[model samples]
Target: MNKQMTRAFATGLLAAAIALLIYLYFSPTQDLSVEKMKQKLEKDDYVVVNATTYHQQVNELARLQKEISAMNKVKPTIKQKETKKQTTSKQKTNSYHLVISSGTTSAEIGQKLEEAGIIHSREQFDEYLKDHHYATKIQIGEYDIQQSFTFEEIAKVITKQK
Candidate 1:
């Protein structure tokens, strides 16, 4: 009686194994594996990355942008007489509205300021940016500037706009 029962149990286990194999072989959906992942990628499909890594990358990007803006600040060199002259001329200054974008470099900003008659020279303005170590500190916004503003005043306005 013991030998007969052992034989029946072995047969049942073998049958179950065969049924599982057949089910897997005939299934409509393929099993998840490296092959499936590769195929999906080859089809130009989007895949999820680790959420923490993605968030870290985004935070790093924002931090870099802020640093860049702060590093492009302008420094001006002018004599006391020149400053007095500039101050006196400010009353007759023409107004201009300028828009600065976040990704714009210091050279571009200087060029724009020069074009608007806010600064004497783009090269000088660029040098000021380098000398002052104002990288990405220039606020990204719409600004109302005037031609009569001194270089120092313009720098302060551009860098500290609310």
Candidate 2:
């Protein structure tokens, strides 16, 4: 090829490349706002917990688990069992109606249980659900829960075991 023809071809290719770059730079695009991004994540069922809160939850869960293990190690005496049975019989009338939906969270369920006097601590219940991997397995339905039910029983019931 001639030198002038080669130069013309190179310049044309360079010009086309620059034109393409300019077109890409000037193109209209959809900008994702913070709220829109958050909404999109929520729509996709993604939860973003902060690091501090997540670490705190982990520490609290560990402490609660130790306490649970200690509690489990203690055996109830016959008298304690009898007393518990009597108290449970009396508390049977205290029924809590729990409605779990698609967007329900463990924290909200724990809070509701605590408010209904079905569970002692919301934090403990939340930690238990998270620790036992039942947080994501909770079924969406109406549950007739009694105060006499233990956390394990409650978890099983809510997870569709009952």
Per-model CA lDDT versus the true structure: 0.78, 0.91
What are the TM-scores, per candidate, against the unseen true structure? 0.41, 0.46
Candidate 2 lDDT: 0.91
Clashing pairs in 2: none
Cα distance off (Å), candidate 2, residue 145: 0.9
Q: Tens digit of lDDT per residue, candidate 1, span 65-129? A: 98876665432334566787777777567677878887888799888888877788989888787
Candidate 1: Cα lDDT at 39 = 72
Tell me the spans in candidate 2 whose CA falls farther than 4 Å from its real position: 1-89
Off by over 4 Å in 1: 1-93
* Count of residue pairs whose backbone atoms collide, per candidate: 14, 0
**Per-residue accuracy of model 2 over 1-162 as CA lDDT, tens digit each:** 999999999999999999999999999989999889888998999986778999999999999999988777664565689998889786877889999999999999999999988898999999999999999999999999988888889999999975
For candidate 1, give the lDDT of residue 51. 80
